[model samples]
Target: MEKGIESIFKPYLEPKEVYKGGKNIPASTKKIYKLSSNENPLGQSPKATEALIKAAQNIALYPDQTDIRLREALVLDFDHKLAADQFITGNSGSEIIDMILRAFINEGDEVIFSNPCFLPYSVFSRWYGAKQIDVRLKDFDYSLDVEGILNAITERTKIIFLTGPNNPTGTYIPKAVLEDFLARIPKNILVVYDEVYRQFADAEDYVTALPYVMQGYNIVGLNSFSKTYGLAGQRIGYCYTTAKIANYIRQIHKPFLLPITSIEAAIGALNDKEFIANTVKTVQDGKIFLADAFASLGIKYWPTQANFFIIDPPLPEMEFTDFLMAQGVMVRPVSQFGAPGKVRISIGDQEANEALVQALVKIKTR
Candidate 1:
């Protein structure tokens, strides 16, 4: 007798909440300010637009299988610190994460991350039958509990995920603290750092994990052109790791995985330093503006090094999000992100920022 499909999947099945993005406006609504997704408020880069257009002219040709040009561009952009072979470009940082899991995770292996870290870590881990370990962050500032994570490690632990300027909470690991944690971790376990929002971080102590990768630790630093380069739609990202690990990850990744246009857009976006500079400045300025408004309104919010911040809403998380939607504004209700009763709001353009502030004022009075 053949096994049923349900029976085949029963052992791996578990209740999981899919990643939820911000809500879209009703079709009938005349206007809406979308501050839900942490998208580039400045819009796509002009240079990227030009490059993608040029690359599209040759749509019949397949993209470079080796991604040599894109890797060369990355080397130049990083001031030649890392070789081309050390970087592995992929469709997106999320895809690279999946590749890492596929390359390393065996059945029943353990993967550890903070409770509210990136959603996909656990999502992919489950697909591979890896045991998921959630380490609760420190309560006061929502920072990663280094001690807790260290204690959670066991003989079965295969990988540990860390996010600088972590999502939903906007907290970051300081350089000194991270170094201390890294020093003590067993050399066998891989440490993957998701630094997708690194460019927006201005905290004096915050640092990227690339140095550790160069230092030959089993570290992988993942970056995406989606956020800082304004190429989310393009879906281009890369990871920097040791050559041996890069080769292993490449073995798992399919060739010609990215579109020609995405590769070109990322290359072009690198040339547009002005656009990246402007984006960082805009988010920084908007962060200050929004934080000030929150303080004046007596609304509680946490400090963030990323483009988005979390707030303790006046009402229940879902209720507050619904109210904002009714007011023609969209924000992310982050209950599923382990941030129950809070909402994460992304920094938007000036007009949208003003609209969100106005909406908050209404929430206060209502």
Candidate 2:
């Protein structure tokens, strides 16, 4: 115990609350319906699972650190029209976020994002000793206030992080609105657009920043195989930008690139068109069903463009969550996201969705 050593780490000492997901109740023998974390209800892509199994036999060998095969598959199969060099892979979307901050942000620089958007944005910004400017969500709908974000920018602002189909709320910025916002922003400031839930969106007006990236805008598009391909456990995600920016991120990647099995699984997941299609369909259908159930129960819920939605139950968020847990269902209480008294429920399979609806109904009667 060196007494002086504590002083060195004092600047990094700050209270941080761990992000909570759906709680798992082990004591219950009943079939549990985990609608907590927004995971693929249909499970991982069959092709991805098979690929991982095959790749396991060769785990002793090192994977291509550059992730050439996975990047190529993304371009060819996803019709991105970008060269493989324009993409960079990460252990997870969270890692890419961290790398972006590490590579571009400096101490005392300002980072702007919505207050309730993503927990990691604040967590990482603080870790880097950057100033965080959080713009509050507009009204009860929890929509992003584009004007607030635009006005919050200062000369020292290094990055602006926007999550499409935003976490916790499942709300998104319209394509036209985002285009207008970007046009007004100075090109010197980098914009990080996290489109992790883009595949689940069915709105005609929804769009990706890939087109903006193609036009030489100072933007980076972050995506993950976690949701669409059910590869959360695999921890694979990627980012797309100009080749130059991609190169900077890759440099920081160094010895931290994704493992061999994750690369193979991502490649297989990208190639499996059927699995992707079915996953989208399931999420869309489940959303509709859940919306109907909410209406029937007279519960207030926000319209979601992603795989989950926030609802204000008759009970407090934590109490409601506990009730669901006791009934063998799990959901997320988002007080940490700055919207207290609301819970976010991920769309599960039909049976799981029904279980949640039935639980709510029983709670109402009691």
Candidate 3:
């Protein structure tokens, strides 16, 4: 018999724990508040819902392989004077990250990113046989040490992943710091900026890297319809870079990129500016409410620019998570992100937020 498989696939033989959404509570539970995933509590846009319903009739037809309409809509949405050729659509933002890795990384190359930014950056880098250089966050505030990142870079560094309003910690990169880092890095290295949570960020200093791409810098900005548009189930994501890099990703892109329904939904979502504004407002309000609640309970939380925040819970993270789960409230334990004592909570609607606070209070008292 032949050997089982290539040695490169050995690390993946054991499945890793992936990101998960909130779970359905047991039947005996009276009420369930799903605050695990950082999803729009108000749900998907009404316009997108209507579009999806209408597009359902044409399910048998193949989607636009080139994603022309979707790309055009995105161009208009960004208002960045971008050509449609500068974009590449994917099933999700996660897939776009994968595409970027596959397009640039070779065995023995190095991928550098913060220690706890996004899990996929590390996972995908290892899968591609690239060495992962993880720079630890400065202090416990989850601030990115740009100097540390610059120091970690070497000739073998092919890519660096930066996530704004980074996952779990909700920290962000200021525009000035980003520009300084870019200026120091070699042009041969490509920087992937994951801005999936950009819409939720209210920070004045946070800016998209599209300008860098337009300036012919080696940077790609990855975005998604999942968060602000509440189209997570639709699985639509896109990236913008220089025409050369965009064409490279497209070459690796399989034909029939996204489902027809997803295309229609993204278009509808893009057209509904009022809906997107309302979603942002809702998240902003929820974040304030949660912050106040956490403070009342004497909990320490990292200041957040994104829709979620990490709290140093009174109990162990898993224990706290279990306590909340038993009360029909689900939140994420940050152990997977390397912070065993902290828990990450997604900002939910009024009712869900209240339920989470009450649950925490109950746990603290008991």
What lDDT score belongs to each candidate, Candidate 1 first? 0.89, 0.87, 0.86
Query: If both were scored by TM-score, which would come out higher, candidate 2 or candidate 3?
Result: 2
The runs of at least 3 residues in candidate 2 whose Cα sits more than 4 Å from the true structure, single-residue gaps closed, are 1-3, 18-28
Off by over 4 Å in 1: 13-15, 24-29
Model 2 Cα lDDT, one tens digit per residue, 183-297? 9998789999999999998888898878988988889999988898999889999999988888877887766277889988998898889999999999999999999999989
Model 3: CA > 4 A from native: 1-29
Listing every candidate in turn, what is its Cα RMSD in Å to the true structure after a full C-alpha superposition? 1.4, 1.7, 2.0
| Residue-wise C-alpha lDDT for candidate 1, range 1-366, written one tens digit per residue | 987777757466567656655555568635788788788999889999999999999989998787889999999999999998899988888888988999999889999999677788888888788999999788778988998999999999999999998987999999999999999999899999999999999999999988898899999999999888889888789999999899888877778888999988999999999999999999999999999999999999999999998999988988898898888889988877887788999998889999999999999997
Query: What is the Cα-based lDDT of residue 349 in candidate 1?
Result: 81
State the lDDT of candidate 3 residue by residue for 135-243, as single tens digits: 8788657888988989899999999988887887899999998999899999899999988999998888898878899899999999988889999888889999999
Residue pairs of candidate 2 with colliding backbone atoms:
none
Candidate 3 lDDT: 0.86
lDDT at 333 for candidate 3? 83
* Candidate ranking (TM-score, best to worst): 1, 2, 3
Model 3 residue 24 distance off true place after TM-score fit, in angstroms:
5.1
lDDT assessment of candidate 1? 0.89
For each candidate, give its TM-score against the true structure: 0.97, 0.96, 0.95
